[model samples]
Target: MASLLFYMSATVLFAQSTVAFNCSINPIYVDIHKRAVHGTDIFQYGSFIGVGTPAQNQSLWPSLSQNITSFASLSYCTNNSTTLKECTKSTGGFFDASTSDTFRELEDFNTLDNDRNGTFDGAYGRDNMHLYTHYFETDGASETRLTDVTIEIAQKGDIAPSIVGIGRESTVLDALYAQGLITGKTYALYIGHGFDRAKGAVNGSNVFGGYDSGRFTGEVHKYPMSPDTKNPMTVRVKDIIINDAAVPNGEVSLFDQAAFPDMKSTPTPFQAEITTDQYPLALPYQITQNFIKHLDAQKDNYWGDNSLKLKSQFNGSLSIVLDDGFTVTLPSEVLSNWSNITPIQDRDENSTSPNYLSTAFLGQIYLMADYEDHSFYLAEAVQKNNMVMPVSWCPKTGAPQAYQRPQQNAWIKQGLIGAVVGGILGGIGISVCAYCFIVAYLRKREEKKIEKDLERSKAAKIEQMEIEEAPEFEGPPKTPKTATPFFWKKRRS
Candidate 1:
């Protein structure tokens, strides 16, 4: 049976309009383990959260953003020819027919399995358009934090997925920009979520290479004001969220040093009595869909007043079958054009006392709202960093406190000035040259047009002359032939 699920987002400009969301059933669920509060749990809503009434319906981005704000379908987009479609009669997921192996078979076996098994209400041909959650937040008037913060995977079925879930991963700002996600440059949120809590330094285990030399801190987030500020420690970083991508138990940052002096770093030293606490999940999540929507605006179409509309299409869809038979359908994930992860170097690269050298994983994708915003994120950050470093990463959208917005009019005025200058130069050059060299060629075109017209005129005149001349020949048969009796005989051989 064929099924059609319609999704429409009617939104106004960011500043003038606020987004109010109401789905037939948007739900989200979060499950958290509290180490500090012992035996406690915290739940935050997510993806399926959009399916229900607005539990949290406040604009993360304001009115100026309203003009460009968007709600996108999250999933995978494929060439369709890249992977063959395999019809399934059971709970649906991406089943690679070529190898008959699932993504779960490749990684996160049990967790993946658990997610897959929970996805069906017994329909054979449900076009599962799964929703992948990305954390977004509006803090104060400056709206901040749009990143791959919390990534929850869900599908629409007879039942809805829960929205309460914790976020994961750091902000993906720079990568998003290069890929063109958000527009006008906004802040991004990086999230930290899992169990446990701390208010101080979190050291890493057995560090070898860092800015200050080979040091080891075995924790995450070590609060500077902690009682044991100097001692190695690991404080919980759950409240620190970058964007939509959350940092699960192991996804916290591999900081130059722990948030606390006693914080955590990845690759803990293999030793006894070296107190290596389990870290938050290492947040390395990427979206499966990149192309959100292609838009076009028509003026004066509505009420004869100025207004605009957007046209969008989902590239394609993907299937996810969790271990427990939870099948989720999603659109294709878009990819940032391949680029090198250039090193972040300070002015003292060759000097013994260099300023900053981040030990970050190379090639992390940062998603922005759009090209302009991406540029602003980088440009502003560069200025803020005082251009001291050659290159640095951009923060994601929705996290504005970290940045200062630019004046819009000044930028536009500069463009107008440049255009005027170009116009003047072009005009002057045209006046000086008069395109003299090509005068003959242009003249020739006119000449050809005239020549064709003249030829037609002459041809018509000649025809008229012929008609006038015809009367002379028709006047009388000059010297008419006389009848003569002459016998001719045919001789046959």
Candidate 2:
């Protein structure tokens, strides 16, 4: 009996597990706040996280390459001759070890360059971290807290601000998975265009363990993670084309040798890393030169070596075709406007120049990374939608399919239809069973009646035979005959 009870309990638990798996898998959606970072004119999208014992909120950028989360220290601003408010505005917020009792320094000040830009002096430590879904939450009700998380306090550096690394390492995603806040070690990002809320700029979002399907459009291309673990999300560019009235087909490839004969060499397909640490699309020197010549652009000494300004007006869209046949086209406004200048830059024709697609590229495409599977996906970004559909990756299948919501009345209608159909089928089955049972019972009753008649007929025949075999004499004569037969029988014996 105990074993039977155990089996029954197991069956119930299995059914519950099945139901949970088929239901919607909710992912953690980290919404980005649109505002300008300190010391920069361009409006940036960042998430607000709390740190320390009392939960001092800090705005931090999501780094795709770095694993360790770092925040600018209060000393960093003083060293740079900046005030606390300005520093706070610039670097999200500064970390003050003196204020937090839980802060523990793990390593002394040392130079670190994890961002690949340059080196900075900082101390490694552990502290409490808080992540929230909304920016305006002050009550800490929605906070997801982590204890003794590895963090950095940047004492001196030219680093922009605090950054939460979501790379393939022991990062926050791993911590979230460990805490059961998310299902898997996966995340998706879509950096929408324009930061000015007054000018109709849409905000972007970062999701953990899932993706927002409404933020992207078209077919998604899946790419295997590069064996080079440091730069796993690398893509190859096939060609760069732009719309030009001067060209025969109303468009021209930047790689066209005849059109730009002065290029250093024939342009070919090349690999580039996708990163969020910078904002320019770094390309080969030859391709950058081709763009410069076609657009009648001149170097902007004020901006930097790679920055350029238009010498002649050109209204044409720039399209980048990937080796996988996915094309992302940049509108003319993104190419022409001064605010959006320097979208493309040269990766100096040298051995050390790294070819990469920077944060600007992410502004046009949606990126989803699944570290557990060592794969990533890319799709064209959409800016106008307000839909916030977050879908999870199936733990068993490793597929991130969105949970499609049926129409408002669909479930009810389907349920009613199913009930009516099932009822009709059930009724037909029951009636057929009843008819067969009634026919069988009647046949059984008829068989029993035939048996009774046979028994009665046999008994009547026996009685009739007995009557016929009786002696022909009357009652008085039969007694004398019986006595004579008895005496003869005794003598014979």
Scored by lDDT, the top model is 2
Model 1, position 488, has a per-residue lDDT of 40
For model 2, the stretches where C-alpha displacement exceeds 4 angstroms are 1-25, 35-44, 80-89, 108-115, 135-141, 194-200, 301-305, 394-399, 402-493
Cα-lDDT of candidate 1? 0.22
Estimate the TM-score for candidate 1: 0.17
Model 1 misplacement above 4 A: 1-236, 239-386, 389-414, 435-493
RMSD (CA, Å), each prediction:
29.0, 21.6
Q: Write the per-residue lDDT of candidate 2 for residues 1-493, one digit (tens) a residue.
A: 9999999999897666444432354677777665443334534457757688977676677777777788877778667643333444456666777788789988554423354553346788888888766623232336678788788887766555588877778467877777667777778987665443112366677887778877777788888778663557888999999887777989989988988887667799988888877666778888887888888777664434355667766678888899999998877766666543557765455646667787667778889898866888898887666567877753334444433456667657669768878999999999999999999999999999999998998789887863244434323333563556432222211
Question: Model 1, 193-306: lDDT tens per residue?
Answer: 211121112211100000101111111111111222111111222121111122244222222134224323322211011011111111111110011111121222221111
lDDT of 1 at 38: 8
